[model samples]
Target chain A: MTFIDMLGAAERQNHSMLCVGLDPEPARFPGRLAGDASKIYDFCAAIVDATADLVIAFKPQIAYFAAHRAEDQLERLMAHMRRVAPQVPVILDAKRGDIGSTAEQYAIEAFERYGADAVTLSPFMGFDSVAPYLKYHGKGSFLLCRTSNPGGDDLQNQRLASVDGQPLLYEHIARLAQGPWNLNGQLGLVVGATYPAEIERVRAVAPTLPLLIPGVGAQGGDAAATVRAGWRPGAPIIVNSSRAIIYASSGDDFADAARREALRTRDVLQAARADSLRVATP
Target chain B: MTFIDMLGAAERQNHSMLCVGLDPEPARFPGRLAGDASKIYDFCAAIVDATADLVIAFKPQIAYFAAHRAEDQLERLMAHMRRVAPQVPVILDAKRGDIGSTAEQYAIEAFERYGADAVTLSPFMGFDSVAPYLKYHGKGSFLLCRTSNPGGDDLQNQRLASVDGQPLLYEHIARLAQGPWNLNGQLGLVVGATYPAEIERVRAVAPTLPLLIPGVGAQGGDAAATVRAGWRPGAPIIVNSSRAIIYASSGDDFADAARREALRTRDVLQAARADSLRVATP
Candidate 1:
């Protein structure tokens, strides 16, 4: 199945918009893990087991893995995921962007080597940089439109005089989305939930495109507002929460706290979706 | 010694601004080394042995090695570099950028695990994102300011209304370099030699910061113009050439051709430096 279909099925099956971020920091990990690859794998597996019913997807930040030269750890993590919950779509958050040939290699690594259903990319390198990944036929690729970082406005909101005069950088990226670049219809945009106004604007421009929304819980982004901003009838939107859910409790009951957080996030998303449906009916 | 001091020493000793980029594409490699890691080791070792005298530094783009998950090849590549030319500085071209903790892990990998003299970074995550790498004290971290890619203008040139009411994204990054972020004073900027004007502009903004100028030869970036734009008296400016040198010949004499190209590039750079010196003295 295509990444979109997988995501839609997962969302419908789980009835959740929550995409748990598996950002395992060696320093912040509970003493039990203690920088051991096996222990790290165990921690992630337990969290996945607990929250699998409450999340549509899993987003693992590749940097956390690459930092450790933890190739073995990554393989183990993938094995654990495949065994425990094969249905949950894993979205690898790599933010990789490079020239065409190199980008092809990255695509292979993300899709074939790691078996990620989707991956995030930095669109700063232009459309061609992402062309190789998009060529994966069924795999999904999310381009960074508006990030959750404080300095996001430093460039994303710049008013550029393009053919469509006075357009922001994000707007330009959205406009490009309408071209042949979205060929396989697997293109998605990462419009941060932190920027609801911009999210609304991007939605208006590319209504059909799926959105991988980050920055909900610990990032102080409003989950309700983000759900409202990105809500489209039956469209896929993965609202990710990392630290708030995964590290809810660093103690022995960390997995339980994570489950509780995931459950709450899913409940809120379902409530928002119901409200949107009600308003549309009226 | 500081990264700047090491760069200065290398520049004087080699009498060249050339940084040979070891972007070994497995498919494009020559000889019996086809898809083999030992061949890559031999190829790189031969190039280093022949050209270490002509160039100040070697930049191995991580994507090349990373694409091939052949650990034996990577280990051999590193071992060859250590054994063949210990004096030449190796700048690992991995554009890594993550939050503080993850960034620290990357710093450890680049400086400790891989033993690279410097590593390139993508500064989109903001100043704090790269702070961990800068905290390495003596290791150099080159921030991506102006990339050689065509779509580089998408965000790097975006204008923003800061407290001062006028700040371009690249300029904002440059300004950040001047503040406390330079705690270790090991900050460097990556301004592609493709844009001479922007190179001059960035140089003017942060004169003291070393510039890792990529995009010469095959990328159509002019080395002489870049030297004119960024050359400072006794400052470190590594003009990198990857494909133009490494892939100079696909035949069995490929290593010799690589050496020849490296010599030619070094001579051109030395001439540019000499011209700049004369201009400065007069």
Candidate 2:
């Protein structure tokens, strides 16, 4: 299935918009799990077992896998997801950007090699750099529109004079949602939950595209505010919680704690969605 | 040694400013070599052996390795560079960017896991995103400035009103070379050779910083024009030619042909530098 279709089914079937970020650091794993090459896959496998029915997707950050020379563990994790839960897609958060030919190689790295249903990319070099990723017609490409970081304002917040009303760079990029940049119908933008108003702006620009919303939990973003500002009836905004959910406890019951955190996040999202529905009724 | 120090030593000893990009593709390789998983390593080993003395640095684009699921081959390639020619540094063209924690993982992947002397970065997420890679005090981080791609105008060419003269986005990033961005003194920028005038602009802004220039060989960028526009006395601006150098011949003599191509590129750069020196002698 196409990534968006799968994401829709997962969100509907699970009744959740929460995306569990499988970022397993060796230092923060459970006490039962040995901090070795296999720790990442084992910890993630247990967590997936505990919370697979509660999340719409699993966003695996590539850095943690490569940091410990645990790439074979990453391969095993993808295979586990495929074998155990095919409905929940895996969005590899690589955030890679390069030229045409090099970008094509990166696409193969994300999809053909690593088996990601979608991959996040940096759009610093513009359309041609991201074009190669879009060629995987079945896979989704999440461009970094307004990232959720303390230093995100360094360039993305710069106001461009050529644009009408002199919108910020992120807004200008969001406007491209209606342009030829999304020719393949598989393009999405990453609008961070930390800035709820910016999320609203991006939603206004491209209401049809899916939004991967990070910065909701540990980054101190208000979950209700994020849903009220960004969420809609049909738009699937996958809100992610990495540390607050996955590493909720370091004890023997880490997986159960993870499930509790994920369940709480899902309930928060559901409550917000219901409130939005109430306000929408005229 | 630091990236700049090693690059300077190699350039002086070899009397060349050429950087051989070892981006091996199985489909484009010579027929004599078997298309097994190790072909990338064997081909690159031969190419490196043939042209070790003809160039200053070796840049291995990570996409080629990751595309074929030959990351182990990449590890082998880095080992080969250390064993065969320790003087010439390897600049891994990864162009990765993310938040602080995720970026730290990528830094570990590039420097600790694969043993790259330097890795390319994208400045989309700002200083903090590029800061983790800088923590590796001995390693180099090349930020994406004016790339050699067709869609560079998408955002890199936008004029920001916040600047004094409404400079292009790439120019603002170039100005960072003079600020707190290079606190580690191991930073560089990737300015494509496609636009010779843009090369001059970057050199004008960051006179002391080294520039890794791509688009010279196969992307229709002129070698002499690039050198004439970018070369300085103490500053080393590396001119890269990947396909044009490595795939100079498709037959069994591919390594020898690659050497010839590297030698010719070095001569072209040398003549341009001489012309600039004679013109400035007055």
* lDDT for A181 (candidate 2): 91
Which pairs clash in model 1? none
Off by over 4 Å in 2: none
Tens-digit lDDT track for model 2 on A84-109?
A: 88899999998989877788888988
Candidate 1 local accuracy as lDDT? Answer: 0.79
lDDT of 1 by residue, A1-282 (tens): 898888888888898888999988766766476556446667777888999888889988777776667656676777777777788889888777776566787887788878788888877667777788877888999887777676566556666643366667777777677455687888888888887888888888778888899889988889888888887986667899999998888787889999998999889988988887888899
The lowest-lDDT stretch of 10 consecutive residues in candidate 2 chain B is B29-38
Which clashing pairs does model 2 show?
none
Q: Candidate 2 DockQ score? A: 0.88
lDDT at B122 for candidate 2? 92
Cα lDDT, all candidates: 0.79, 0.88
When summed lDDT is taken over every stretch of 10 residues in candidate 2 chain A, the lowest stretch is: A30-39
> Best-fitting candidate, measured by DockQ?
2
